[model samples]
Target: MEPHVWPLYGLRITTPRLELRLPDLDTLSDLAAVAAAGVHDEDEMPFSVPWTDGTPGERGRSTFQHLLGTVAAWTPGAWTLSLAVRSEGEVVGRQDVGANDFAVTREAVTGSWLGQTYQGRGIGTEMRAAVLHLAFEGLGARYVTSAAMTDNARSLRVSEKLGYHPDGLEVLSVRGEARTFRRLRLDRAGWEAHRTVPVELHGLEPTLALFGL
Candidate 1:
């Protein structure tokens, strides 16, 4: 991508085993195919939006449109960095870190999903470490927040592994019934204490202004 026109596309975050970047159209299509194959079973939803409930085609379209929309609608005051997670050479998942009035609040929220076949490995944990590295060390964010359904043990485990303290819980309607969720938070000090992975930021200098840095 042309950095002058869309500098966010030039941003990259990497861990020892993973590389995250804004996917070009062709790579986005590949990521969409991963979504189309399936992200979870028909029974449970780890996400609040229920984006994976439909047919494979519908899920793929939702993934593509949601990501593209975030890029189109971004502004420095409020934006979502939705980067495609790459392992080895394959597009495996998506990770997001977003904020509103970030320059003032110095806070951001994280969200993500992985294809079903890729779930059991430690990729979710490593990719998350990459973005948290971007938020605190790269962007000078003071805090990051995330939530997971109470029944979603894997997501909770990832948060726990990353040194996020359980802030509290909330109830929400999902699919149909009420669901309880665990809210987690990590401050810069906490992240520094428990961060276990080595992460690197590249192409970040040119994108600082876009993040209100």
Candidate 2:
């Protein structure tokens, strides 16, 4: 973890009960195992990409490869931070924050998943809050966006609690079928208004350039 070449590995976002950081190989393996154990019910898919619709082994492999792909494809103008979310000192999930031409737009998008065993504990909200803090406070972002399936009440509820307003709607093909998603957006004022979690960002200075800040 010297982060000599990829300084993003040095960034850390901490909530009162969770810590989010880019995973190293070993930590990445643990995160993949969490995915293998399952993040959602077998009958339903929350992601628009249908990435979780696979065998347990395939799901794990996909998680591993996707995280690596983000790192390999990164640029200062467009980058994704796939952070392993840890609670009680163990990896429990993953949180992703990304932007396209962030220096010009000053906007970012967030996504996340938690192991089935770790759900319903408010970990999701805390982790997302940590990233929002990084975007608005640490990086001077003006807006953060998210989207959840229309039927994903849990995700929509989280967005509402975080002071996000419905921005629009879109339909996409998932699993060979059309699915609708509710788009949510939060501006700096909204984020500051609903900020409840105490977040601490560490080592972000070294990685600011990586985010095109």
lDDT of each: 0.93, 0.94
Candidate 1 lDDT, 1-213, residue by residue in tens: 677789878888888889999999999999999999999888788878899988999998998999999998999999999999999988999999999999999999999999888999999999999999999999999999999998899999999999999999999888987889999999999999998999999999999999988
lDDT of 2 by residue, 23-104 (tens): 9999999999999999999999999998898799999999999999999999999899999999999999999999999999
**Highest-scoring model, lDDT:** 2
Query: How many residue pairs in model 2 have overlapping backbones?
Result: 0
TM-score of each: 0.98, 0.98
Clashes (N, CA, C under 3 Å) per candidate: 0, 0
lDDT of 1 at 135: 96
Residue 203 C-alpha lDDT in model 2: 88
Q: What is the RMSD, in Å, between candidate 1 and the native fold over all Cα?
A: 0.8
Candidate 1 deviant stretches above 4 angstroms: none
RMSD of each: 0.8, 0.7
